[model samples]
Target: MVAVGYTLMCEQAGPKQLVDYAVRAEDAGFGLAVVSDHYYPWLESQGHSPYAWSLLGAVAQATSRIDLMTMVTCPTRRYHPAVVAQKAATMGLLSDGRFTLGLGSGENLNEHVVGAWPHVQERHEMLEEALQIIRPLLDGETLTYSGDHFEVPEAYLWDRPERPVPIALAASGPSSVDLAGEYADALINTEPDPHVIDLFDSAGGAGKPRYGQVAICYGPDEEQCRKIAHEQFRWFGLGWKVNADLPGPESFDSASSFVREEDVADSIPCGPDLEAHVAAFKRFVDAGFTHVAVVQVGDETQPRFLDWARDEFLPRLRQL
Candidate 1:
């Protein structure tokens, strides 16, 4: 069976909040911890985007059994892949070999904080060059190279992990997906749709497992949950005029004109209900997602999230 896990979108509140959540997640019966890795938030107005690697280091020292990962780490534009490899290797050591490296081509909005904007195609091209260097460096091999996109002469990891760390790549388009199968051990994606998984596999990941995450809100009241989810994810439904463009949650902008404020109610799960969550998760499972995570957050759910997981969601989900 694919073991159930707890995925944390770290609150960046403080030390106590971070420690307490990691502990509670472990106690709540999670077999894995998928954390987000980002240099900055999508919108500074949203809140703080704590340094993810620093937090992951703290998490490593705090927990023992739960497998740790940066749900997905973006290696292009912001931090050098060499730096990421070093941090990831150290964390893997601290976690006693329980950590995995998750990678991606990344988004311009997040990456542009340090560098200039690049189109989607250019971003993927950079990512390709990044992985080529990152994977070898992490393996603790001496490097000597000069490439159009990147270069390293006599560079290699000294404090590499106890064992080779598994590298997973995230991609949404055909070229990136094909490159993933050719160079990566696994795949990650925001949309947990199976069709995309099939596409990646056809390109190369024939025997690899795919991990995905979908957003949902849980609360004591269903209506309350929907309101919270819609406010956060309406951007997804907002982007495209047609619903088919987005089969998943995001802040998509739709409507030729001002969008009638989106109703989040249909987007997330709320209240003490179990049926809806079970049904919602099934969409991911049916799509061939072997490892899955539920993005459950918001003020109402964040503080008592573990309690809810232990008392509610897990009971219903484990049965499936």
Candidate 2:
């Protein structure tokens, strides 16, 4: 059976609310919770972005059983790979071995805050170099390294989980899929694309876990749900190519201004209809995702959504 997970949505909620929701999600019986690591919300209207690592520490202390992940963090810019490795190790110890570090090449929206963002190919190269430093340290190694894009004069992780934290790599293309297969313990993606899964397996991730995410807006009223999804998440409708290159929330706001409610409603499973939500998730399962995270779009709708998930959606989704 595919494991169902919840999105922590750091971009939409403050640290306290994230911790509270994580506790509720565990109570709601979600087996996993993926939190985004962003310096800025995709749009200003989304209204928040607390440091993800700090929020995760609180999440670790607050929840007992649910697995926690970064969703995806970029170690190439703004953070050194050594720091990310240290953070991941500390998180693993704090969460009692339930933390998974998810890494990606990153987007300009966040990375650009420090300096000019590198091109897509160079970004991937930087990520590969970072993994070289991160993977060994998580395995409890002390190292001094020099690479094309990064340098670690000397670094070591003194505190680490008995078992190395599992690493999941986010991939949406051939290059990234190859990287995930060669280095990651698991795979992560936003789409239900079987072709990517096949590529990942053939490239060296055959037995690794595959995680997928699907956005949904669940509410008593369909129209309200549609409105909420479009208003907060229309930036997604612009697609990753555009989404990754944009410099800020204002850029996203302008780029996605053309997105209509119907467009978001068409793609995301909207409203309280059980079957619609089920079918949306089934696509990822059908495409062979081992874990499918339900990204609930609106922050205000979380309490109601969590209640409904515990009472209804999860049980039905498990059957698929």
Q: Report the C-alpha lDDT of model 2 over 1-320, residue by residue, as the tens digit.
A: 99999999989999999999999999999999999999999999999999999999999999889999999899999899999999999999999999999999889988998999999889989999999999999998888999989999999999999999999999988999999998899999999999999999998999899999999999999999999999999988787888889999999999988889999899998887999999999999999999999999999999999999999999998788
Candidate 1, residues 59-89, lDDT tens digits: the string is 8888888887887777766787777778888
Clash count for candidate 2 is 0
Consecutive 10-residue window with the lowest summed lDDT within model 1: 243-252
Clashes of each: 16, 0
TM-score per model over all chains:
0.88, 0.99
RMSD of each: 4.0, 0.7
lDDT of 2 at 197: 97
Q: What global local distance difference test value does model 2 have?
A: 0.94
